[model samples]
Target: MSGGGAGASRSDARRNRALVLQAARSAFAEGGLVVTLEEIARRAGVGAGTVHRHFPSKERLFAAAVTDRIRLFADTAQDLSDVTEPGEVFFRFFASVARLATENRAVGEALETPELSAAGGAAGAGREFVAAFEVLLRRAQEAGAVRGDVVIEDVRTLLVGCLAMERRRVAAGDTTGVPGRMTALARDALRPGRTVTELPSAPRRRNSVECGVCGAPVAVARTGRPARYCGGACRQKAHRARRARAQGRNADAASAGRQRP
Candidate 1:
């Protein structure tokens, strides 16, 4: 191939890769890994073969997406490296990670890729993340802001658990900013303190609340109005009961009016 032709081809390939990566990020964030590569290709305005050429498997694509995020975090840590308040920098970074994970569900899912451990392991790119986080942790400890005993591994595990808890609350339909609250709790626990305080109880939900008619437990969605009845049958029954009560009230009022002056 001619030199100019080869350069054009390479440029096109790079553009396609960038598009695929962007589509993967948006798709996975909105729908998790359930979104197929074909959908991503369509979103990226590329062919299926292009996506396959760039990312051999779903696992690889997932890793690449997460690696991109981890690298960004590493960059952020570098920016905070010179800050005077080590503790504040560390905690603020922690909160930022949690907030982003909350906004992008894919981050939380990537952290808990139980099934993808073999094929979808986090990129060595995370090594940069680890090194960056170590600096933050070390600084915080030196400042006596964070607990001296805590290590990076502990912080990682805690972050994963915090994301899981946030997802659990969101799945249970807690509209409140559970991520911010949980991050605050984690910050409190990580501080150099005499005793590790127990976390507060999760916000109560009515998953156990009985159906208005069938007396069965109502299944609540993560968003929107809470369901009062178990299904259409129960809902219809409740509606009928309310209509009947209204009719009975009307009948009684009519009877009383006839007897009155």
Candidate 2:
């Protein structure tokens, strides 16, 4: 073929691939892995043959879609490397990721999906994303912005919890910046606080009175003397033990008197 024709063909191929990937990402985000290649091609305004040329299988396409998203997240986190305040940079990046995951439920779900470990570049991209976050977390810890005891796993768990809260808010039709609110809460929750003194105090135990006889937890009596026993059986047992002790003491005293000269 002519030089111009070859160059034009290459450009068209790149355009088609971009279109397919864009469509696949949207489709996967909306419909998950159930979206077919034909549907993706249709959405991309390309022929099924073009999609197949770019991605031979659905799994590869799905993996590519997820990996591309992960690459975006990793890149964003790394972009904050020049920021002076580690805490500010980390929280900003976390908010961005939380918003993305909240909006695209399938993307977050796929990241945590164990079966996706075998997917093409998806697993590798996920690892890269984790490494990037770990770097940020380490920086924050070193700066004393994050607790030393907190690890990447704690951040991951907190993010997941924030996403869950976002989901709940969405389901309740209250999606007015829920992601930001949740991320802020999560960031505070993840701050330095390993000891009880550093952490928020636990809620007071309410109406917790131990049983007099069994030593089991019992409800505190609102009225009358504060309940010592859980029930009548326990009260009776306590009474019998008290009586037995008193009788033994009295018998010992009587025996001592009789032996006296």
Each prediction's TM-score against the native?
0.66, 0.62
lDDT for 108 in candidate 1 is 66
Total backbone clashes of model 1? 0
Instruction: Looking at model 1, report the run of 10 residues with the lowest lDDT sum.
Output: 114-123
Clashing pairs in 1: none
Candidate 1: give its CA RMSD in angstroms.
21.4
For model 2, how does the per-residue alpha-carbon lDDT over 2-118 read when each residue is reduced to its tens digit? 999999999999999999999988998887787889999999999999999999898888888888788788787788766789887887888888888777755767655635534
Give the per-residue lDDT digits (tens) of candidate 1, residues 1-261.
699999999999999999999999899888878889999999999999999998999878877777767678778888888789999899999888877877777776765553442333355546666688878986776666876446687788888877877767777887775447777876777886744554343334654665654334567678898888767755775687699999999999999999998
Which residue pairs collide in model 2, if any? Answer: none
